[model samples]
Target chain A: MTSSKILPAMPLLAAGLVATPALAASVTITIPQVKVAEYHRPYVAGWLEPVGGGSARTVFVWYDVKKGGREPGTKWLADLRSWWRKGGNTMKLPANGVSGATRAPGSYTVPIPANLPAGQYVFKVEAARETGGRELVSVPFSVPAKGGSASGKTELGTITIR
Target chain B: MRFRTVLIAAAAASSALATPAMAHRQWLLPSTTTLAGTSEYVTVDAAVSNDLFYPDHVALDPAAVKVWAPDGSEGKVENPSKGRYRGTFDVAIDKPGTWKIGMERSMIGGTFKLNGEQWRVGGRRPPMAPGAARPSGAAPAGAAPAGAAPARAPGAPGSAGGQAGGQPMRMVASVAEIPAGATEVKLTESLSTYAIYVSADAPTKGVLTPTGKGLEFDPVTHPDALVSDEEAQFRFLVDGKPAAGVKVTLVPGGKKYREAEHAQELTTGADGMVRVKWPVAGMYWMSATTEDAKPSDKRASARRMTFGSTLEVVAP
Candidate 1:
């Protein structure tokens, strides 16, 4: 009878000793379609920002800087006004962190860091023309304690993030 | 006293005979002093200083002044007029180097001779910020900084050159206009290889000559191979509207000959620069097209489009 009672108490003790570490979360952005002109390519920038306003951190950048074998200057980066000001402007050397070849009309995937702080966050995207105006899209999501996922899409286009 | 009087008399005689000699001042004004790519129509500003004579009274003798290029070839001024005499000449300097436009004022009545300092033609403009990236193909002298990475491959954009923290040098091509039918293209980029693309009508026999600053093509047989006298048309859609611009050859293929063709179709959008290869010289049509095969109700679904004008190449 005493042994039975002790086993019951042991179960409660084990539950008290167990520790719960934060879980990992992820996000992915996709564009259904895009239109571009000849002699022109699309420039896309994606990044994460705080709930309020300030400088957001750069997540990715894509464009063709060289023609044959030449580096078009970083000065052109400003042409992506929305992202450049929020993220790209602060980068010292962008060769690695936020640069890539120009993207053809297709879908792209970006994975969010699992270690990111648990809270409310926003994903911002900006697409600019080599010759004219720009389009901007943003999606807001939340990370819960158990690493719950939230997703939203824009009428400008569709973006699925998990 | 007699010797002094004789000397004074001689001096007075010389002064009386010396009429203010009428010397003309000539200036060479290239149609464009600075060019990014192909340029045609070099305007030699043969101006006589307005202070010296009236515009209608002063005259320039075409035979008096001659233009000698670095190469053995030579050209004379055309359609010389009074006071402000302008010489409109067609030039195709295939390579980038110092081109001497020496002017010799051969006055008929006066003995005033003036020589101009050799004008340094076809020199590249200084590159922007040294911090800007350098081209890869050929490595410039020196090693990278302690923590900096090695230079990337040729054509890789944003690669740096020079010593640690040193200003990087940007390599640029200087362009020049060449007369149509002149054969022999040249290369201008030092210690670098360039791919040459002629218009469809350009001659296949055209050979590229490399020099200190750029490249040049030789033995052009096509009448339209080097000259862009006729205006070309390029059309594109901007925000779903049709737009177009006049295409001009900022830099002729003969001067600063990089194997690639750099012609700008100045349309409504960003400068329309289309890259086309000139295979065997012959007549052909060229155009750039950008169309969306699919459309949706969403604004983002609408695709932007761009198309280039048709080019007619005349083989030399």
Candidate 2:
């Protein structure tokens, strides 16, 4: 959810608390185009794992949330094996400001959480495609980081953290 | 038939034989290699066919198959059924780590000489007639003949150590059964291992530990977490030691749909490691065989060991 939309709905006090920071951290993810007989949009999960040792924090989950059926696309969320093991299994569905629908093959830039304490951290992004493949890439950076980038060979493309 | 044509074309790169259908390729294919839930089930298909992963020749025996849980305990095969072409079974994975499922069989059989006579001791199959169809209900399905390649044990019963063409033979189980004072006797021990790995939540190490016997697969890269883009390193061990110069053959699945086998033949290095860079993402069958004089038993002079597994690799 964009801050402009939420800003108008919140009261004066809550709006001040939820206001976007001047220099918010952002991540740009590129979903690559895969050639195959059967290609389904990859389910992607982004999270942060402490470099030293701590619980993982989910940043975003991109999937077919509104997929029509008794069983939604959430059933396949576990296909993102790495993220599910790290922290996804504990998260509730349709988390506000973090859950969204799947996207096409292209680049997307989204804001990252700015509340992390000053310390080393590793940002992880995992994508899994039905009848295709799975790929996970990690980028290490410190709180108030300037930037970092990593690339995936198959299911995902280049990922940049700012 | 069209299938025969494809098989011949696919096998051309590997063998010089005009009709390569006589030799069977055995494999066990799991439904999924990695899963997420607490208690998920994985279905597996077993067969010995001309084409890899295509079940057309014979079904494997479920009795010979075993499952090892992620915790290193024996698991159960929930439902098993043998069809005319393949065998199917389901394993309930209730743990979080990886599980190993497949078959391991060993037998002691070889040529023995006694009083100027050479006798074949293992089970034998009557060479199938050219273009013969599936045999009727005479032989039991998936029963390994007593004294042959345990990997081929699921084959139908045939002449047991019986003379095929004026060769005197005796069907016996062990070398001890041979008469005493047998001169110039040579015996061989054959061991075969076939397996597949499936992970529930994450890949673990408990089931991947080497037994240090026969042929062992020690993967530097986890078997269940392999990706086609990166090279995977695996070590082969013979009698708990590095098996250098061992030939490893890796063939991708879906031979029925392709013209070439696309098989990669790699030899183990001094550390018994072979690096595999897969050409594509899908299921693959890998096998390695070695023959040495290190027999576990004194009765056997030579030992033959084979290790095979079906692996699924992801895109990245």
Candidate 3:
């Protein structure tokens, strides 16, 4: 719905939306053990959202990796609210380097294509369990940037981006 | 990869069920919707109450709650504890913009039968979250609250069946989807979301960006300036525009169980906005719904789209 008041729009203090990579930057995201009774492997989605406002590019998704049939975990990707809203709704699954099976509570890394340009960008990771709890974490960084680390106290653990 | 695409298409087939719906009423009631200081924090009470505004349902933990700050970072609730009727936690607003806090997207689903029997629960857990009150109706007689000790046995309403103490909806798990002669009845997939806005200052952006993936309410007023004494308008946008003919509901909170008993229903205007007000502010929620012209491709008997949100109206 459009607002008619028509005031000068406030600029959105953009999240860490940033750059293109010159080489494949290997980033590791860790999923920590939550120690809950109903512990289900989380459906994870990570991507880079441009701070200047453009479509978000998919980084990777982790789900029930073993299922190859019709009723795979693919059905619930939308449960990852933030990612699904931005692009998961129309995303094609099993992107060669961007999709993989759900991992254990350990560190996993993916090679991010290095050709992306240098700029500020937000690296987003969202996780949702089968029992209905969900969480999202975004790390603001710049391309051709230094590596840093952040963690989600609830759903995820240390994330190291170079 | 082609095989994965087929599997994804299959999942996309049922993704319609993931669309937003009024599966349950989750309220994110905050002590105040407007915070003036960057270091100040507001207390929020989140709950899944059957009686509406009453904290008699399940309790949620602070860790399960998430807060997206105005600057696009995750905000955590501090000192989360179970209150008498709701889950209480504190959020610190370090920026001067709109912050989003609520329970993660939760789904409650089960079978509905033609035999006049039905069952459901809050979120995905069969047992209510720890420290919340027990289920009050006849259903609790069969199973114990989940996560609780096996204080009792499982059986239908006083039957002497063996106890499955921690499973609250044991019987509910058995109802078959569309049992014989149940053409009119069907399996239900209910999705729920609870988000409350805290405006530390005038919010010009990000307060009402409709995801368009589900039923969503966008505020017409500057979220930082919402006042309980005045009526405000919220728009129910479907497909990113004003949705006409949608049902908008406002239930003011004060007395226990009074909200459900005295809820008001209004239809959206030609512009898809519903004007709502609070007589006295406490913790209030607004929910809206719309029906599609055709059944979902899944051929479910009835298809509906729902949107719900928690509103913390403050005094002038």
Candidate 4:
């Protein structure tokens, strides 16, 4: 039974990759006017999720989790629950692959995977205050057999992300 | 073929059942004590109970270590030399007072699984000066000076006569004088945690003074009200210029949601002061708007002016 199941499943799994595109794909998220007061910069998280279900995979994370000596733990990563449960929760280091420094209110861009599977995908942008509220902004995009680019925006009230 | 299949299934079942139960036990370990008032070295050791249980070659995640000096100064240890399934850190202590060392371990990789835990390195009692007799005065060995009660040492034994448990060692006591006209505020008593004291007045600002060891401030933003009393007396400057009648809004950080509901909004006073009582502790982002203000002619005018500082309030 196992041999029969494996023999048929392997071809289907291999065929599933036929829809993947080989173009340089990218998604840029811009948040404008992030207000930095009291030396506290904004913490931002970016990720991609399947259109309907499954998991959210993080593509970027930015924050100053270190003070003079205090370190931010993986537990704190849970603060970005939507991203943590999807992508960060499974990786050895959340900072690896998708890490950026905490930035003042301004425009920032992240490159998406060029080899993303062709499908309807949702891009999520979530910004949290180290000392304030959380805002989750999402934009939907599609990856064709040929990869391309997509963009989105979120207004954080004196803060903007495009 | 059927017989071979049955045999393979039996072997698989036995192998699964025979798998060993493994426990990972990696903990932060530091020297028991260091001589006070000398160039004494204190070492932090990370050890695992069993080599088979060791997860990975331990390395100090530079951001995880917080070291506080006797004089209130703080510094972080960023690098750790790797040992066989362990890590060792040698630190220099140059003053007399309690030195607090705190560390957290991360489980990077391996078959054994261990969740991270914060561990303190030093004992409660300060390392006594070599050959110095216990104070001859009537005070107890660990008692604070007259008119001041000594803060309880971390991990200290419950009773005075309790058996000397292997708690982390601390340094000898040193005088922490609240500068003239400054009131001492008692923050939390946890080791390596912030214990802040400030002057009891409006526009209060003071710096921590470390006696010997260097002090480093936590860059992470603390709750805003932690520094000032609620109903803060704020001074507003727009574009580096004092502006009156400016509409201002204070936005709290995401972590500060609990306190955001209570943060007050105020207009700049005639003197550019915006006083509002803070209802909770957290980070706040204040934005002031001036209707018709133009860019200043001065070179400094081009610079954007915004207050970015963390405030911490401690118990008195």
Candidate 5:
């Protein structure tokens, strides 16, 4: 079953033009609607980390960027524990193509970092909501190759990397 | 030494079960557990109370509390104040990662002979010099209440005797004050520590490393990163090694509004690990105690250790 999915990317692998624009990958993430008395849009973070664990490359983050409080919405970014521990805490917020406002319940597509070297990576999508639960879904996919998908049961839904 | 270890372990197990009902709970409650910034500051409340986190009993001395930065260097607290019920202080988190704030106290107590009467010494009293006469007309400060003190009969030093009501036994300054040729000399030292963790950015483990003495928390999961519905593994250690069969208890805050204590009692596995599963996001007070034969001071025959920490668990 797995080999069938990889066959389509075999030609590009054989040609060794893996870094071409045609091979650029994107991830599709779904934010599930959580029912609660006080529902706040879940803060989401999408990043690709090495399969064996190393530095992480963040694809995008959806958070409260423009709150009028003395401290910005980034104050609660630590609620996304896994991402924060994996170098998210060190990031300078509002980075280009990496930071965005929180999205309502829906699905969105985000482009992966171009020029990523060939290697096994796990694309992780984590969502944490106020007055609700948190969930993380990981899709293992290699750069310059086929895609994979995984689903979360709570705050996050389907996550696909292609 | 082997037989003594077994004997102390047995005594500790029984005493651990009996302590909670009679002794007050001490904790340091941090204002916030996690943060994200170049730096942040957290204010903490320290108190001893019947209910967890409730400050109705007595205020802990703010000067006794200490702070350790993430780098394991000593940190400082600001604006310390002691009210009737509790004490408060602020810690500046100029450095990133986790920080520790709490108290560490050690005391030695023993049985001795003064004027042919067997007396006990302990608590916060200063050690008495050897060959010195017991102080006259100076009653011991902080004497245990009548029923609380371990009653001992005169000349029956080694046996754990039954209670005798009245103004509790006189506590001499130390075993050194015992007259020459005194028999059944026994000295025990105790170390007690209480702490809470706060993270300015991501959590770090340097401050969580155990000092290889007494009962300590060796968190398999980072203390500042705990959340509800997730299982956090914690290991209890004695003398830097895994301490097995110790009893650990977790009592949530807001006991004033609750009907029962709702504490979770658990025992450490052979590996000294306890998997804690929180039912909800809140502040929890954790406590564990153990007695062992390892005494750092050669003058002490046995050692007792107590560990306590206030942990905040957040919603997922």
Candidate 6:
């Protein structure tokens, strides 16, 4: 394990870290619990916006996918107005991975599809609760054509590029 | 049961009602979630009113609204108009993709109602509810009317405390102060968020992957491959691990789908996955959420998480 001859190459490897994990790009977002008086599950959505292009790749959306009716229920989606603006509202039914029900407070991993284009992209996550407030956090990561890696902070944490 | 206990308990259990118990829903009704191509136009119906059953519309300030393009470009509202319980505006899709058009994250508030009227109790004024009072940047003092106006002002701590059964008076507390022994004060602060998407030349794929936020849902399958009458499976990622027992909902897509009494609701398996039968045609939206009963810090109300998305199913 201790090859002095290859020690110098370690620096190069460190430099290349950012260019690694192209197929392994993944993120584990953690929602820290806040001790408030009132609590309700939030409406959450995450997406990837291309650096300069006009397209976005959705990570996932968790909400009351089945709680809406024509009357007063369909209106709760507005609790996450920002996500709604960014395609959260269009995801109405289940398509396997794109949408689902809300998860408990914990760390959730969003696996970047193995085949992702390389370029500058922003990993964004937004959360909103019925009585609770809303928070949107994002971090920018670069995807080298072959591989890459990077990390994020503020609502989002531990982003890995495989 | 000295009403004070209920108020304090509610505050302590802030998770009781998703928002301030009852808030008039101010919403944005979009004409279409997606556009066919670039340079397309979409209309949105917005209002700030208690339109629950009323046909009236109330106008939201045009300056308070902004339309965000797919590339994050900002557009000001145009052709602004107002009606009973509603307001309306139109914007052109400059770039191809989903556009986010909604009101700015400004606070809308009003005086807290105590026993049916704006009042105060022992040393504390009532909570100021947002989204029901004057718009942002407006003076909060004059929001109360002349006759029913509050007798005292709020914004400081350690104010003089009144006795039990104190007269109902209009008053508000500052951000720094929480009432000492409030018998009854409705917890204030309500937020309404609405999102919808459309297909602008078939949804494109990019680096839009999960960045590991608090809660996330990712498509293990190719999102674009979801088609009509096909069985698709999804996985739930909570804190980066497979989430289990989370409730996921799938609703048929259509203008009246919200009225469909028979939407599908299911839970993720132990491995954080769920299988569903895709509809034959039309658009579909899926949503899921989970919450933490115990919050982490005092600054937070409660840790609530939600997710929603849309897909296109071809006709059989």
Best by DockQ: 5
* Model 2 per-residue lDDT tens digits across residues B1-316: 6554444333321221111233567778999887755556889998877678898866776776999998878999978998877889999887778899988767666666545656555433333334344423222222424344322322222223323335433333445445454556677777778889998765788987888888888889988878788899999998788899877888999977888999999999999999999998899988887778888879788877778889988765
What is candidate 5's lDDT per residue for A7-66, written digit by digit as tens?
223343476555646347877788877777799998999888988768998888888877
Give per-model TM-scores. Answer: 0.27, 0.70, 0.45, 0.28, 0.70, 0.39
| Residue B20 lDDT in candidate 2 | 22
The alpha-carbon deviation from the true structure for residue B284 of candidate 1, after best TM-score superposition, in angstroms, is 49
lDDT by residue (tens digit), candidate 1, A13-111: 465564534433333334334343543555767777867655577766765545432324443564565565454645543356356665554445454
- What are the runs in model 6 whose C-alpha is more than 4 Å off? A1-162, B1-29, B46-66, B75-77, B80-82, B101-193, B205-228, B231-260, B268-287, B293-301, B306-316
Docking model 2 quality class: incorrect
Each model's lDDT: 0.35, 0.73, 0.59, 0.40, 0.74, 0.50
State the lDDT of candidate 1 residue by residue for B1-316, as single tens digits: 5544433333221221111121222223343221111222234433332221122222333344455433435644445543333333434433222233333210011111112111111222232344454444433322322222223332321222332235333321111211122122232111111111221111222222223221111112221232233233332332323323312222222223346444333223453322233443322222222323232212122222211111223222
Query: Ten consecutive residues with minimal summed lDDT in candidate 1 chain B?
Result: B105-114
Which portions of model 4 miss their true places by more than 4 Å? A1-22, A34-39, A65-75, A145-162, B1-316
For candidate 1 chain A, which ten residues in a row score worst on lDDT? A1-10
Higher-ranked by DockQ: 2 or 6: 2
Candidate 4 global lDDT: 0.40
For residue B254, model 4's alpha carbon misses the true position, in angstroms, by 20
Per-candidate DockQ values are: 0.01, 0.23, 0.01, 0.01, 0.37, 0.02
Per-residue lDDT tens digits for candidate 5, residues B215-273, read 88999998887879789999999889999977888998987887888899999998989
TM-score of candidate 1 restricted to chain B? 0.22
Q: Candidates 1 and 3: which is better by TM-score?
A: 3
Cα misplacement distance, residue A96 of candidate 3 (Å): 60
TM-score of the second chain, cand. 2: 0.79
Angstrom error of the Cα, residue B199, model 1: value is 40
Which 10-residue window of candidate 4 chain B scores lowest in summed lDDT? B105-114
Superposed by TM-score, candidate 4 places the C-alpha of residue B14 at a distance from the truth, in angstroms, of 46
List model 4 lDDT by residue over B34-147, tens digit each: 231233456665433322113253332324456766555774454566654456665565444435555311111111111221221112333333444331222344554522
lDDT for each residue of candidate 6 in B134-199, tens digit (9 for 90 to 100): 322323543433322133233322232233344423444332223333334433222222333333
lDDT of 3 at B300: 40
Please report, as a residue range, the 10-residue window in candidate 5 chain B with the lowest summed lDDT. B157-166
